[model samples]
Target: SGGLHGVGASVVNALSEFFLARSWRDGYEWTQEFSRGKPKSGLKKGKPTRTHGTMITFRPDPDVFSKTHFSYKTILAVSESKAFLNKGLKITVENKRDGEKPVTFRYNNGIQDYISRIVQGTTLVNQEPFYFEKEDDFKIECVVHWTIATDTEMHSYANSINTSDGGTHELAMKAGLTKAVRTYAERRNLIPKNIKSISPEDVYEGLYGIISVLVKNPQFQGQTKEKLNNPEINSPIDTAVKNACEAYLLANPTMADAVVKRVLLAAEARLASRAAKETVTRKLSSLKMNLPGKLADCSSNKVEDSELFIVEGDSAGGSAKMARDRKTQAVLALRGKILNVEQVASLEKIQTNNEIKNLLATLGCGVDQHFDLSKLRYGRVILMTDADVDGAHISVLLLTFIYRYMPGLISHGHIFLAMPPLYKIAAGKETFYAMDEMEKEKILAKLNGRKFDVGRFKGLGEMSPDILKETTMSPKTRTLMKVQVVDHKATGKVFERLMGKDPKARFVFIKERAEFAELDI
Candidate 1:
């Protein structure tokens, strides 16, 4: 509603190569046809019909657009959202291009149905969503529920259009919810004595909420409609949300207590995280002369030239250090898998692990909130493990730690996985390496029946310094997969399911995907 104004149909019609419209109204069917924005046929009356809607069919001009394909899933999602926003409204979508089945979206409970779907499988602080709708200057419908998660999820819409870049309405909603929760907690003296105060960040940590407002004339920031810019709608929305939340909390004492406890726990975790960050900063500031003893430091002080190779075992570390260019390449050998930060309860607990401590000290960049990319000692942080299942597991463990603690490394493209060769082939004087079984077979096929010696490396420990350098450590010859986070939410969910404390989640995941798993045996 806020996105395209009233000219969306006209614009689409103008941009289409072929456009056909059929309308059933006033006991008659009317039809019109247009080609390339010009009328091909005048509006013609057809057989009498009792229907009361318009049907438009159009083919996008391939000459005007780079691509003219439509995604059925994307259209269905928008239809579902619209149905959820407007209660009892039914929207149907069908894709004839790909022969997709028709889908009908209708929700009776409006945004409450949306909240139910979001919190379906998660641990909940609120048994049911706290829902309320009010009308003043602008109609506001808000629903909220609290989960046991450490992260917050909130969706705000203006005039049925998603406001992803939240504007005045979102800000007001947050303020109102924060005020309500804080007031309730303070009234009941639910806050712990150890906790000084709670911030909005704490109260909304695990909150899942949907705020939908119907504005007569919504002022959007841009053509995208990602944000609502109307400042006048703030006060009404704020008051409505505050009053609704306050009333709900007052009526549901048990839910209120649960919410308060959840908020306090979040506050405590926030405080501990701040303290851990401070501790790391203090240590990093003081420990310039005391890099980890296991780290084979490079001669180059230039961050752009320096590399840190996190090798799997001491043997591999030794070989990497021996083969490395001492001016730019440094190696730090981890004994085995490091602590899984996803399973850990707190950042303080992560700091206590010996392997993690050594890593934090070696990197120079502070952990968590105190992380500074400018202070990093290395341009590249490579994970060089064996080319096997065990090595992949170890790499995953290390990645989990890095993802939870120093995500900046992955985000900034400083993290990489070194591709070590698993098989070594010698055809007379020429030597070649293969990373996997498929690669080895391909290489053998290319050899054309020539007699050759094939050796399978059990681990990186088995590789000589020269071989290891040639395959993995050398920048010019080696293949490195740069670790990146394309989708933060999806990646985080994967880590949670795999490395989290919930064994049941991991079990279910493994069971579902066991058929596709490749056995190292």
Candidate 2:
């Protein structure tokens, strides 16, 4: 039996070479087969089976896919997400090829359990999660919690499908939370004497929440169920969550106290960060603080025409600075590894780090809420690090910083990772730069089985200034991957899992998807 009721299985079947669906209905079992969305055989009556369920098996068409093999881990992740949303549903996925045991996932606590799992590494302001379920001709349930971690994660769903793009329900929840928090803060004197009122942004600093709504007719914004579009459900959800949260806070004084304290701390930090940003602005306005002494900035004032390359070490930086075009490319050479801002609290503290300070100055945009996209000095912020494990780690750390503090940069498609060719295949006068195995094979094929001398480039430092420019730095030849946030909450969860101080959560995450990992020697 298989839990294959949604869009995925049908889509999978449509694109597959062979698909078989076995179903047990009433007192009998039946089987059917299809090939490329066409029915190969009609439903055949089978002997009565004791089991009451369905089983679907599909092999993807090789011609239709880059690779026909399916990722077992990807399927498991999808199943796990489904299991989290559905409270009582038991989902099991198995990789039958390797004799691997099936993975069982069943969450009785639903989204509440999911919240706990998500914030495993975080320091909670309120240990007891706020959960409420209400039904009045409609169904809506919400689970929310406040954490000391200075990141917000809010996920919404309609009929168990993730609404990553958000819709009416999400907007309503945000509005309700904003209103409720503001009202509660004002009433309880949670706001500091000097500060006026807490903004919605300030209040959501350390919040983690989940909202799930079940509707008879779900109006999805896209085919992918990226967003919910039912505007009618907004008022009902707002009322339910608002009333429930207000009552819960009033009843639980101790928990309310904790929440208020955390929010107040966030407010204070917000104020401090703003003040720091103002100071930076004042300094920049008053003093002529030139770009990093090591950097060779481009002449282009138009952000659209400019690209910034964040290179590792002064050696690579120097070469890049010399090699890059003066009119469009700016080189910022990092002396050492940057501060892993995931664990840091004060933005001021983060600003104190030499590398980060230089970066902040070079970028011309402040961090956190104070970050002004208009102030960005370059349109393309490319991370051009050594092609090694250390480079990858550095890139991840930089990404974490940007994601946590400068998310708008990513959202606006300003951030990019420069892909440098790994190997240079040369035969006689012919030379080929191969980025990966596939590219290498293509190049080899083009050579008509000619024996080629392969040269593996270890790092950026090894490459000459011309080679570096030709392979990575040159806009015409460079391969840059733009950073995109598909799901902000999912992205936040990944950062929380990988960079946070939770060994158990990291272990579980890695163990569950270990097979999918492409390890370097």
Mind sharing the TM-score for model 1?
0.58
CA lDDT of every candidate: 0.86, 0.81
Models, CA RMSD each: 9.9, 6.7
As a TM-score, model 2 comes out at 0.68
1-521: candidate 2 lDDT, tens digit per residue: 12133467777888999999999987799999999889999989999868798888888886665324456766776688788888989998888887899999999988888888878878888789888888777788888889887777788888877776678888788777767767777788777787787777766878888888888888886566768899899887877777778887888878887887777787777777777777867876763356677677899999989999998897888778878999999999888789888778788799889888788778988777668899999999999987767788889989999998898798767999988777799999977787665666767877887889988778787888998898898878777777877545577888888887788988998899899775656
lDDT of 1: 0.86
Candidate 1 structure quality by residue, lDDT tens digits, 282-361: 76668766877899999999999999999877888888888899999999988788988897889888888888888888
List the candidate 2 regions with Cα displacement exceeding 4 Å: 1-75, 96-99, 121-127, 135-138, 148-150, 159-167, 181-202, 214-232, 261-277, 284-309, 313-355, 372-380, 393-397, 400-416, 427-450, 460-521
Reference-based TM-score of each model: 0.58, 0.68
Clashes of each: 0, 0
lDDT of 2 at 197: 73
Worst 10 residues of 2 by lDDT: 1-10
